[model samples]
Target: MRADAQRNRDHLLAVAGTIVVEEGVDVSMRDIARRAGVGLATLLRHFPTREALLEALLRTSFEELTARASALEASDAAREALVSWVRECVAWTTEYRGATELMAAAIDEPGSALHASCVTLRAAGARLLVRAQAAGEARGDLDGDDLFALIAMLAWAGDQPALAPRAEHLFDVVASAVLTGAGGR
Candidate 1:
């Protein structure tokens, strides 16, 4: 991409990210273009679709979380690492109002724009879960998919105005349930 084009794309992504957090993933394309001080055609040229724009905006975050999981994997406390990663994932997902639904759907849809990122993220979490389970820190019955579902569920709760107040408590409950004997040590 040309320098100017890349700059425009970056600006649009930054604007879109803020708007998505404020409004939602379903916010109109026109609104994003207006907010970015660009024409719809220009915005469309850079990101042909909403999903494309969102994929670009969110891919970096997903990669960061995945990298965080890797870093956490090296921690001596496996259970804490897993819990921390799960908390981070849920927090990130809740940042984008409608992202949890998209992530859940994208994980199952191979052709979705966000599929690869979501899959990699889930795999990263899965590795952490496996590590914890191996150390008898997490429940043996829980797998990556279950962890993914837990993330989505927790994120959903965080996104809700009513449940937002209880988000922390619910996270503690869910985390405690996932951990094994005596809070999985």
Candidate 2:
């Protein structure tokens, strides 16, 4: 990773993100290379496959979510933080229409390209869940694994056209159930 190479790699990632968001994952590698101002060979050298490129792109989002979890726990009360984070997770995971199912599959299959990103997402959630449990705001019986499942389900529901309208209501219900001990609040 020399200075010039790093710069080119960063540019590729930036352009790739913009194009993917605007056009889609189906955008051609040649288009990405052209937009990135890099050679096709360079792009291929950096990301050998579409999945590799996508994995690199999604790493940033997963890192942001992890940082957000830490920030929420630092600033908010345990109950409030837990609820807020669940909403954030739902929105983040559903950012791409089909990302929820992709993430769910990645979570189960350790060898998937997105497995590391999924792990980070789950760990961020588990941290929130642990804090809520410690404060007795959430159920002690549940763990981060359970929280992850709930998040995946919520993301899937959020992306559905029919279910989208009911998504917020579903979140409220799920949050309430998780917060079995309101601590008399």
Candidate 3:
């Protein structure tokens, strides 16, 4: 991409990020284009669909989270690593307001633009959960899918205005439930 085009794309992504945080993943393409001071055609040219735009906007952060999981995998404190990754996932999901819905949908739909990222993220968390379980720190009953559901549940709690105040407490509760032995870290 040319410098000017790259700048234009960056500007669009920045505006879209702000709108996504304020509104949600459901915000229209037209609204994003208008907010970015660009033609809808330009936005569409760069990102053919809403999913594509969201994938572009969210991909980097998702990649970073996955990498964080990989880094955490190296830690000997398996339970801590799993809890930390779960916390980070919930935090990131809440940041995008309605992203949990997208993630939930994407996980089951391989055709979706967000599918690969969502699957990779789930796998990363699963690896952590498995590590914790192997170390006899986390519950043996829970699997990767269960871990993902917990993340979505916690993120949903964080998204609700009423529940937002108790999100941290709920997180603690959920994290403790996931971990075993010394009552989790």
Write down the TM-score of every candidate: 0.98, 0.82, 0.96
Give the alpha carbon lDDT tens digit for every residue of 20-95 in model 1. Answer: 9999999999999999999999999999999999999999999999999999999998999999999999999999
Better model by lDDT: candidate 2 vs candidate 3: 3
**True lDDT of residue 2, candidate 3:** 98
Point out where model 1 deviates above 4 Å: none
By summed lDDT, the worst window of 10 consecutive residues in model 1 runs over 176-185
Candidate 2 TM-score, C-alpha based = 0.82
Would you list the C-alpha lDDT of every candidate in the order shown?
0.95, 0.83, 0.94
Backbone clash numbers for all candidates listed: 0, 0, 0
- CA shift of 158, model 3, Å: 0.6
- Model 2 CA deviation exceeding 4 Å by range: 22-40, 182-185
Candidate 3: stretches off by over 4 Å: none
Name the candidate that leads on lDDT.
Answer: 1
C-alpha lDDT (0 to 100) for residue 153 of candidate 2 = 91
The residue pairs found clashing in candidate 3 are: none
User: Which window of ten consecutive residues has the lowest lDDT sum in model 3?
Assistant: 176-185
Q: What digit string (tens of lDDT, one per residue) describes model 2 on residues 1-185?
A: 89988888888999998887666666889999998877899999999987788889888888888898999989759888888888888887666656676777788888889998888888888888899888878888988879999998988898777999999898888888889664422
Alpha-carbon error at 141 in model 1, in Å?
0.5
Clashes of 1: 0
